[model samples]
Target: MMIHGFHSSRQDFSFGPWKLTVAKMHVMKSANVEKLADELHMPSLLEMMFGDNVLRIQHVSGFGIEFNATYALKCVNNYPGVLKVACAGEWEESRTMGEHYKEIIRPYDWTYTTDYKGTLLGKALKLKVVPMTDHIDTEKLKAREQIKFFEEVLLFEDELHDHGVLSLTVKIRVMPSSFFLLLRFFLRIDGVLIRMNDTRLYHEADKTYMLIWAIQGLR
Candidate 1:
C-alpha cells in the first residue's frame, strides 16, 4: 500500500462521513488518483489479497484503502450536494511530478452523488459523497459464442518435437488458447521422433502468446 505522509479524518467509513486526515487529503489532492481495476460482487480488494490465494497485479504502483463503490453510491443516494459515482477499470495517468499513478477498483460499476447537498463532512472533505452498494450488473457472454470461438481458435497437442544438433522430445500437451499461433515440429533421429524446443509468440493487440515447437532450424 502507498502512504503519502497525509492523514484523513473520516467517520462513517461507509461513505463521506469517513474522512481522511488533512495530510492524506493533501496527498490525494496533489496526486492524480485513478482506479486500476473494476470487478463485481467482491469485498474490498485488499481483503481478498490477505487470503491464502496470492493475488496478482499488473503495472501496480502500490495499494491503499481505496474509495468504496458502495459507500460512494450510498452517499450519492442519501446525501445532497454529492457528486456522481462511477466504477472505473484499470487506469493510468501521467502527472506533473514525473510520477505516474495506476490503480484498479472493484464492481466495475458505481453510483454518483452530488455535493450540492453540502454535508459538513463532505464540504470539509471537498467531495461529492458517493457511496457504493451491492447493486451489481450480472451480464456475461453467451455460452455458444464462447464455445464456438474456442473450438475454432484454440487447439491442444498431446506431444511435440524439435530438431537441432540433437533431437529433443516433450510429453506435455500444449494448448493454443493463450497464444496466437502454436506450431509443432517433429524430427526423426535414430527411428525416434523427438522434440527440439518450443517457441512462444505473442500478439500485441490481445497480448496473447503463440507457441512454435521445434524451431531450432532458424538462426
Candidate 2:
C-alpha cells in the first residue's frame, strides 16, 4: 500500500516575536493501506498498519537554531480503537563559520504517554560544539567544547476526537533563548517526520575549483 499526496490547507499567524504556521492534511475517507504507505514513502505495507496517522512540527530561527518533533498514532492489530502513541525530536544550532561552528544535541529518545492530556516530559542531552581555529589552539580543537545547549519540555493534550476527526496538540519550550516559531503538519499514515536541510559551500586552499556531488544510485 502506498499514498501519493493529500488535500491540505495552511495558515500563518504572528504575535510579537512569535510566529505560527499550521498545515492540516485530510485523510481520504476511502484510503486503504496501500495508499497510505505510498503517501508516507514507506517501503513495506506491514509498517503502514502499525501507525494510522502522524503529526509533525518544526521550528527554525535565523540564528541557526533548528528543532523538529513528530508524533505517531499507532493501532494495535489494525484495530483503530486500540491505539498507542510515540514521540521524538532532534535539536541543533550552527553559526556562519560553516560546519566549524556547528553544535549538535544527541538524538532524542522516544517515549510513550498513557495520558494524552496533561503529559509532560523533560530531557537533557550532552551538547558538542566545534571550536574556532583562530581563537583556540589547533591542538585544542581535538577536545570540542561542551555546554548545556538547551532544556526541552514537551506537553501534549488531546484537542478533538469526533467521528472521522483526529487532532493532536503539542506544546514545547526551549530554554536559554526567547525565540518562538511554529510550523505544523498533519499526515495520514505514520512515521513521517518533517526535516529541513541547509547546505553551503566554503572556499578551500590552492584556488582550484571544487564541486561536491551527492549520488543517489539505486542498489
Candidate 3:
C-alpha cells in the first residue's frame, strides 16, 4: 500500500533480492527548526530558504547493497562554503545593517550549491568511481512498458529572497523488467546565473549491477 501528501507517506516494493522504499514527508516543524538552524551557520541563507523539507528513497538488496536517495534541506544547502560567482548581494533589498550584514554572508554560498550524490546506508560498500564505459539504456526507457510504480517529490525549494528560484526534486519508476530514477537540483538567478546537478540510476531485472550516472554544470 502507498500514501501521499502527509508527513509520513511511504511506499515499498520487493522483487527478487531487492527491496525499495520511498518516503515522502513535509518540512521540519518548530521542534526541529532549532536543529536545522544549528547546522546552518549563515543567517542570511537560512532566512531565505530555512532548509526544513525532507524526502528520501531507500534501496536494499539481500546481496549487501544498501543505498539511500535522499533529498534533505540541510544536506543540499551545505556546499561551496562560499559563492564562486559573487552573487551574494541578491538578498540585500530594502534592508540596512550597519556592520553585521555582510559579515554573516561573507563566507557563505547563498546559491545553495551541493555535490551530494546520495547516502550509503550502514553495512553498505563504499562506491568506486571507475571510468564510465557504459551508459543508461535510453532505448529501454522509450519502450512502452507497464510501469508498476512511479513517484516524484520535491525535496526542498527557496525563492532566494526574490532574486530567483532554487529547488531540488527526485523521481523513481519501477517497470516490469527494470527500475529507473532521476534526481535533480535546479537553480535560476533570473538573469545572473543558472546551474543544475543531476543523478540517474537504472537497474535491469537480469543484471547484477545497477548503473548510476551523475552530471553537474554551472553557467
How many pairs collide in each candidate, listed in order?
A: 56, 8, 0
- List TM-score per model, in order: 0.16, 0.22, 0.74
- Candidates' C-alpha lDDT: 0.21, 0.25, 0.61
Give the RMSD in angstroms, all C-alphas superposed, for model 1: 26.6
The candidate scoring highest on lDDT is: 3
Rank order (by lDDT, best first): 3, 2, 1
Instruction: Give me candidate 3's TM-score against the actual structure.
Output: 0.74
Over the stretch 38-124, how does candidate 2's per-residue lDDT look in tens digits?
A: 453432122223232222222223211222222222211222222223321121121122454333212211211111211112234
Better of 1 and 2 by lDDT: 2
- Model 1 regions lying over 4 Å from their true place: 1-179, 190-193, 204-219
Residue 92, model 3: lDDT of 45
Worst 10 residues of 3 by lDDT: 62-71
Model 3 residue 88 lDDT? 49
Candidate 3 residue-wise lDDT, 1-219, digit = tens: 112545656677775567766666555454454455445553433333323323333445323232222323445444444444434454643232556654553344566676566664434443344666889999999999999988876665667767778877778788999988887888888777788988888889898677888898745
